[model samples]
Target chain A: SQKIEQNSEALNIQEGKTATLTCNYTNYSPAYLQWYRQDPGRGPVFLLLIRENEKEKRKERLKVTFDTTLKQSLFHITASQPADSATYLCALETNNAGNMLTFGGGTRLMVKP
Target chain B: DVKVTQSSRYLVKRTGEKVFLECVQDMDHENMFWYRQDPGLGLRLIYFSYDVKMKEKGDIPEGYSVSREKKERFSLILESASTNQTSMYLCASGILYEQYFGPGTRLTVT
Candidate 1:
């Protein structure tokens, strides 16, 4: 069976600082890794996706890095704001039919102003 | 933008009662998924349909069943709900890579 792990502890950081969250997986090789932002009582919204061949991807204020060798992915929010406080989840494409995904126990980030 | 809508935002049911969760998508996507989110377990896939009448069991499908009679609608069924079945249920629709999720349905089974 495959396993995904994220920091179960909540990460607290000051606003405008950078928040880094980690996701590690074992026993499975994924083709694509993705990050999602989930607010309390809301469904997760897509953040970014990186292929196994890619090293890093960046959006406006979000960056995601994939390290296949380490079976890990790092999600970063630079210049974080209080509104960025939410649970961040990492998912790996199961590479099977229908493009199913396996998600890690997300790390909740609390950005303080 | 793709829109996914679930029938309920919150639900309460008793043990051994039959429960149904409905999801509809306007994107006409071919893939629809049902997942349950728990406190520490993250999001676990219960079932997914690739096309009409084609369903696949996901990681956790033991206590759940799904119906996809039409291309745009998918339903998750709990034949006999249990207390342990209480969780946040989410529906998603996607073509291949990116998925659009609906406002989750918080289900509480007592």
Candidate 2:
């Protein structure tokens, strides 16, 4: 069976530290992967997207690494702040269409001050 | 900025009642999707539409039906709302990879 997995447990880190989250999948070859941030009672907001050809992508404080061989993606937040605490989700394109995505369960990160 | 809007932030319905959830996007995106988010199940796709009047069943579309009569509007219909259907419903629209999402509607079926 095809499955996307994320750590359901909440990750706690001190402010100004680096936080890393993992997403693993089975039985799927995705063309690209996306990461989103979602707060309580709100919909997810797009953060970054990495294609299979790319190994790493970065935005101001966020970085994402994709490993197709291991079917895993890592999301890292540097100099994390309390305001950065939220549930982060990893999604994979299900087909060549690029519109359909399968999302992981999401991992919550808590950056304490 | 791309914006997607949902009709309600919260809703309550009785069992066996017919329910309709509406979503509209200001961006002229060709692809629109409806998904239900649960506690442990994550986000499950209910339905999606690539163009006006064209719809496709998603991973979990058993009791839910969808309509896309207009390019900017997509609707999800529950023929008979069930208790198990209580969940957060999300709507999104995008041209290809990056999707903009609505605020989401929390529906509670008693």
Q: Evaluated with lDDT, which candidate comes out highest?
A: 2
lDDT by residue for model 2 over A35-109, one digit each (tens)?
999999999999999999999999999999999999999999999999999999999999778899989999999
Give per-residue CA lDDT, model 1, range B1-105, as digits (tens): 889999999999999999999999998999999999998789999999999999999989998999999999999999999999999999999988888899999
Model 2 ranges with Cα > 4 A deviation: none
* lDDT of model 2, residue B89: 100
The C-alpha stretches of model 1 lying farther than 4 A from their native spots are: none
Second chain TM-score for model 1: 0.99
**How much lDDT does each candidate structure score?**
0.93, 0.96
Worst 10 contiguous positions by lDDT, candidate 1 chain A: A94-103
Q: How much is the lDDT of residue A62 in candidate 2?
A: 96
Clashing residue pairs found in predicted model 2:
none
DockQ of each: 0.80, 0.90
